[model samples]
Target: LHPAQDIPNARGTALIAKVKKPYTEDPASPVRERQSVGIYADWLPAPASFGDYDQFEGIARIPGQISWRFTMHQVQEDAPSWFGGSPWTGKFDEISSELTVNTLVEVRPFNSKTKKAGQAVLQGTLQRCRG
Candidate 1:
């Protein structure tokens, strides 16, 4: 069975992860809180150079697998004025515990010089943090 097969409403939830191998790899944690699926200003900073974010994209079940995807211009010049994605982009597989984070940041205004942009794929995973 898959890792999150037993998790209730597992899709689209914010998870707390840890750095398994510095910035290059942020291994998945375990299933933890599901209600905190929004922005947390004082949350724990990610130990990776990929940099953390103001919010997390909730996981979603795709055609054959589960995935969480987010982008400002998944199309082209489509994003609004004051709304968009985070600085870090990552993937989490609850079953395999394989979370890969790829950061391609472009903060609003469609294309801005202040935005640090690049699709640098860093490897990692996701799970609940153990206290």
Candidate 2:
């Protein structure tokens, strides 16, 4: 996107802060190709600078493909300010929705244990990764 061009939906490409979780397993059946598991936060934008994250690694890009990617903190609480600005702090422990529509998202830090959806926020940010 051109710098001068207006940001789509008043923002950049949406961001998803996904920390790959352990593969789902089933003891009753034989082991098979495990499905990907994750704990994530959606719509958090990339910081304007790399210095924003708690840790830093080099950013790279494939010549043609979408090579840009950033590793997130294994513990979300330790993440940088860019995770979801300040509003989203302490709200993410588990996310259980596909989030196809732009609307409030329920964040349940204890959902894994309680099996419930907690309070909803405007998903912190609907647009993401502008930087």
Instruction: Return the lDDT, model 2, position 105.
Output: 22
lDDT of 1 by residue, 76-95 (tens): 23443243322323333332
RMSD of 2: 14.2
Task: Give the top-scoring candidate (TM-score).
Answer: 2
Model 1 weakest lDDT span, ten residues long: 35-44
Candidate 2, residue 31: how far the Cα is off, in Å: 13
Model number with the top lDDT: 2
Candidate 2 colliding pairs? 45-129
lDDT (Cα, 0-100) at 97 in candidate 1: 33
Prediction 2 TM-score vs. true = 0.21
